[model samples]
Target: MAGFLVSCQSDARNATRIPPTPSEKLKSNWQKDAIDALTNNIRRKIDLDNSYFKRARIYFENEQYDLAINDINDAIENKDNVGDYYLLRGQVNRELNNLDAALQDAQRAEALQQVSPELYILMADILQEKKRFREAQNYLNRSLQMAPYDGSAYYVKGMLQSRIGDTTASLGSFKQAIDLNPRLLRAYQQNIIINNRLGNLNNALYYNNLALKRYPKDAILHFERGQFYNALNKSDSALLSYNKAAALDPKLTEAYFQSGSIYLKWKMHDAALKAFEKVKNNQAEYPQINYLIGVTLERMGYDDRASEFYKMELEKSPENQLAYAGVVRLQRREMGQYSTPSAREPAQPSAPTRILDTNRVQIRTIQPRRSIDMGTDTTRKVIIR
Candidate 1:
């Protein structure tokens, strides 16, 4: 895994992700079941052209790519108005990790004279994925011409701009995406990251707040809010946000870790231990939690126990150099040479961990995880600070 901590985002041009609304949600489950039943029935009986294509749409929506590909392939075999079939198949192919196939299907769709703004967007995604930056931008331009108000198109444009390191243009494109579609969650996330990278703290916070208002129950959003506040050196606000994130999603290790990190920095060992404890039992995916816990114990005068945790941390992360150092220091202290290592060879070194860093735990931006949204082609990281 890349470092959980990252510097974070810039500007964007990419496709837009369609946000689900209340009415959409209502039909979602019913439609999924209805479509599954209908498609299966259609396949068993007539398997008509329209039936195959309509079934393909349901499969696509529900992410049944394999079934969707089969249905669309059947739909395309008949030859009339097969453009949409080709486009849908191209998208399904992309989902199946068949990039070349996706490109070919898209080309076929365009060749069938079924071109639309959506087709241009799909072509752009394939080109961008293939690393054809210039051609990708051209397709994006074509898409905008056909459907300038398309939110997803604006997002895709932003993604391309950001990929090429055009921070200013990327940021502008992201802002446009949000303006066009207020519920574009990823766009809001990008704004927070980019504004922070550019030292536009106020703008970053503004985006954070906007996201929270729309998604108050999303723990990740609240966790991000904490990181933003911490980065701005607003310790109290950071703590509150972190606490809220933990409350909303008790299993969110990052939120607890952040809260503990703050308490540790403030010299509240008890509080820090409580936070690190949460991380310790939470599957141990994180890199530094064990190390931090050891340090917190040591600070609270539990030298022997602290040494054990430190050694455990080293066992988990052999690269944690500080764990080695902490072990050495604690050993020397036990031998009545607290100030320095013994001149003679000492006993074999053990490990220790509890962040094992300076007095302060650093706030950091985590690299954004893969967006996975159909709109997000590339990736970025989030700050953990």
Candidate 2:
């Protein structure tokens, strides 16, 4: 019986394992499906990451900065390993004017890629906007070190130099940027301003004219031209330029103010009054506008109207010298002192004069002429009748 039991055990052991039955096969198939689902889920996660980044880029390019930020935020939250995720988030934050947040993200990106000049440039721009000139300069220098031929970095450095009152350096930087990329409009504009500040009107005009050639309808360029012309004392040309600027942009208060000032200086009271009136109606809080109106009115001999405007100006700016001067002049006029005839006699006609000699010219007749008799021993005085 034991031998028979051992033989049966051996047979059982040696028996071929049956292929999976239909139900078992179904179970096996189910297991395989589960494994495949898991594999697909992993791939989907990866695809989601890629898709988010792609969509975020699209949003950023379309100027939907908020959406881009949200998408990038999700991507980073899901997996913070991607350096580009942080970099893109930083760009979105910058577009939204969230400089602090942008700086933090950009710094993270810089940590991930030590040699990224683009990141340093972005940081430099934010620092520049915050007026952190020294810091901005340092970052710009770093960016330049990494990418020696970066036109944008040079342009930004130029602007930073200008803000810090380093004109020579600023000019060199701007020129370098222009040489690298001539399409930089801002560099051209700043170059003009620097030239103007240095009293290089010809260069200023030349560059300004160059800018105008590029942007013919730019009101700011025309306004700048007007300023240059005014500096040259070319009032007519200045007025024409100012008029063109004002016509191009009616809401430019400075242009109107400048036009009014030019007219006032030229004693074109009517035109000045019109310009000042526009300013008063458009921007009444401008104390100088009120003062200018008063001045123009006074010039036109409208004392009462001028006084009213002057008082209004004083109400706005109590210490305004122009308003006070206008008021004082108006008061003097009202008191009849400024315009009244002189009370002192018109000088009595001077006695007629005649040339007595080539060497001496004297009055021909006088109330009395006293002379001394030199020949007489006794001192004698003779009155020439």
Candidate 3:
């Protein structure tokens, strides 16, 4: 697994205070004239601050997370008391993988809006990232209490429960979210995964079907349904689902790989070769494709060709069990024995014939050893001569 870490700097300064709404115009006029002499200098600073925040929003929306963080840092340094500003900064920080900084900024936002469910949700997101499931649950619960109708809160809680392996609770939370709003995509995916884990394949198929209905072009949904069918040993259905997924999105490598495996099992060698060939071309570094190619070749009785592919797989993964097993099988077939020891065993003579042509027959009795050391470092001696 790769570790993603990010650093962030936040400004803790408060924004310039604004006068009460009733006196705002009068106070603005009174201050405007007096501050007019220094207006140009102050205006430049204010404009710079505004530009910083504007650029921050643009960068964030454009997914330039590092640039967004820098611009937001400048904006926060100028004035940190803006609740929305802190919220935006926290969002950028989270995108940058600076969960600690994100948590702090989110907490600051919460301080500004003490009962804001959005702030609590942000905090819960950070807690969940840190794997503090209990704390995350508390924050999510608080957010739900503040706004019971927030379907997103339920969805998030469901995700948190799923992470902690609490499938039952997760199912309830997902269903609640779905009940509130049927369009929660994350809930649908999570529900499917949880249902599959719980051996409720029928429910998984149903939810996956529903997800496909909503997201007709979603390759993942088709791929997941294909996997469920494959698990049930319904290869034809699995093949159709995989074909649909692959047709919708040719880049879905798992769909191709799985379909290839199914084709291989069914002895549809040509189809298996084609699927694995695509995987090889698209994802050359994947060792499994090489192993599969070797298997297909072995099935076709091309021992030499199969051996080459198996060797290629071993080059990528020295301890490749399938590659080694292929090598062993091929060697056995080539040498006409499963192992070298059996091939080297001396042939025994037919049972002594009891006939007049034998004239006189001398019988010798042989005794077997108590044990044999199949090979490496031991000896066995029989008492009989």
**Tens-digit lDDT track for model 1 on 1-385?**
0110010011101111112223545767656555555455455654355556666777887667888899788877754456777888888887787989999989988998866998898788788878898998999999999999987688788889888889899899889998898776777888888888888988888988888887788788888888878987999999999999999999998899889999999988898999899987885768877778888888777788889988998888888899988898899888988543232335546667566666578878998888665775356766598
**Model 1 ranges with Cα > 4 A deviation:** 1-114, 163-166, 217-219, 243-253, 266-271, 277-285, 300-302, 314-321, 332-385
Q: Where's the lowest-lDDT run of ten residues in candidate 1?
A: 4-13
Error of 2 at 227 (Å): 1.3
- Give lDDT for model 3: 0.76
lDDT of 2 at 240: 91
lDDT per residue as tens, model 2, 1-385: 2332222223211421212224545755643443343234335653445445555665675567887787778767766866677888887888788999998888888887735787888889788988988889899989999999988788889889888789999999988987887766677888998999899999999988887887778799999999999999899999999989989988877888899998888888888888877777778786578778887777677788889989998998999988998899889988978653222235456668975575565556656767866675556677799
Model 2: pairs clashing at backbone N, Cα or C within 3 Å = none
**Best candidate, TM-score-wise?**
1
C-alpha lDDT of candidate 1 relative to the true structure: 0.77
lDDT over C-alpha atoms for residue 22 of model 2: 43
Model 3 regions lying over 4 Å from their true place? 1-82, 85-108, 111-115, 159-166, 247-251, 281-287, 300-304, 317-322, 328-385
Considering summed lDDT, which 10 consecutive residues are worst modelled in model 3? 1-10
Mark the 10 consecutive residues where model 2 has the least summed lDDT.
Answer: 11-20
Winner on lDDT (1 vs 3): 1
The superposed Cα distance between candidate 3 and the true structure at residue 123, in angstroms, equals 2.0
